[model samples]
Target: MSRDTRAVVEELLRRIAEGDHERTAELFAEQLDWRLDWPADGHPAVPWIRPRSSRADVADHFRSLSAHHVPELNGTSVARILVDGADAVVLGEIVQTVRANGAAYTSPFALHLTVEEGLIIRYHIYEDSLTVARALSA
Candidate 1:
């Protein structure tokens, strides 16, 4: 029996909210589509705002994110989660304080995940990249 898309997405969110980034990566497929709403060049100051490929990269992404942000000051407020078949869309706002500059930024974001056979095959995120970039600037 395969898990539904909503269940997989919910589990992913649960693991992330618990700050278990390594476990969160386990929800993704070994080799899958990954995208962040940043430029191809990526933000010079934000290390985690780059591209990811495999599940290992996914783990690195979360680890880098945790390392760069002030854990106590990081938060997310999900507006809604819409699931249709194998697709799930999560709408929310992310608030984070940059560890380097101590600047906080809040960006409304939409994350689209495609789960198949209990594993996430597609990860796409759209957010205000400039706001995140500014927060990382000195």
Candidate 2:
């Protein structure tokens, strides 16, 4: 039986929320194409927000996030999900506390995902970069 694309996405989000990095990586293709809609040079300011091309890189992205921010996973919520065939758009908010200065980084996020053969092939995320930068740099 083929898995529902929506279900696959929801499960991946669940794993992320639970801080199950290993399981989250499992849901991604071997050569995952992950990107944050931000300038590559901004990586110096926000290490987690960078382009990644492999599952290990994806895990490194989250590890960078974990090192820098304390995410309020309970406050994260998906406001909407729109699916078309293998493509999905998720609109949501992520609440986090910058570990450096204890500033809150509550920002809206729009995520685009493409699933193939039950694995996520593309993960493109757009978020409030300015807000996040200010909060983290504070």
Candidate 3:
């Protein structure tokens, strides 16, 4: 049997938690529609803060994330997940230390994903941009 939408999303999250960005990118469709609900003004200073289209963009986003922050894998937490049909919503928290200033950035996040044929076609992320920006600027 083919993987269901929830399974596909769960696997994607698993790969991300494992810091397997390449594998995560592989889970995305060739023409992905990815959006992080952060201010566009921040993009000039932060590469990962911009919009992403396609798997290569996703990989670049992860690369920028790694370049800017050191994530606390032990502190990462997942609060909840809701999956229906081809869509899934995940609520979680990420703890990261900013590479520039050594400040900690702890933010709760909500991710909305749409999966088709076991590949993620759409990804929308909601998080506290101000907290992240402050950490980066500190």
Q: How do the predictions measure up, each by TM-score?
A: 0.94, 0.90, 0.90
User: Among these predicted structures, which one has the highest TM-score?
Assistant: 1
- Per-residue lDDT tens digits of candidate 2, residues 1-138? 124779889998888887877778888899977778477755467878777888887777776777787665336789998898898999999888888888876889999999998989999998889888778777
Please list all clashing residue pairs in model 2, or write none if there are none: none
* Candidate 2: C-alpha lDDT: 0.81
Instruction: Write the number of the candidate with greater TM-score, choosing between 1 and 2.
Output: 1
**Tens digit of per-residue lDDT, candidate 1, span 3-73:** 48889998999998888988999999999999983888688877888888899999898998888888899
After superposing candidate 2, which stretches have Cα over 4 Å from the reference?
A: 1-3, 72-74
Q: lDDT per residue, candidate 3, 1-138, as tens digits? A: 124987898898888878788898999999987888468534455668876788998887777887787665336678888888888899999788877778887899999999988899999988988888777877
lDDT of each: 0.88, 0.81, 0.81
Residue runs of model 3 more than 4 Å from their true location after superposition: 1-3, 72-74
- Ten contiguous residues minimizing lDDT sum, candidate 2: 67-76
**Clashes in candidate 1: how many?**
0
How close is each model in CA RMSD to the real structure? 1.7, 2.0, 2.1
Model 3 weakest 10-residue run by lDDT: 37-46
Ranking by TM-score, best first?
Answer: 1, 3, 2
Minimal lDDT window, size 10, model 1: 1-10
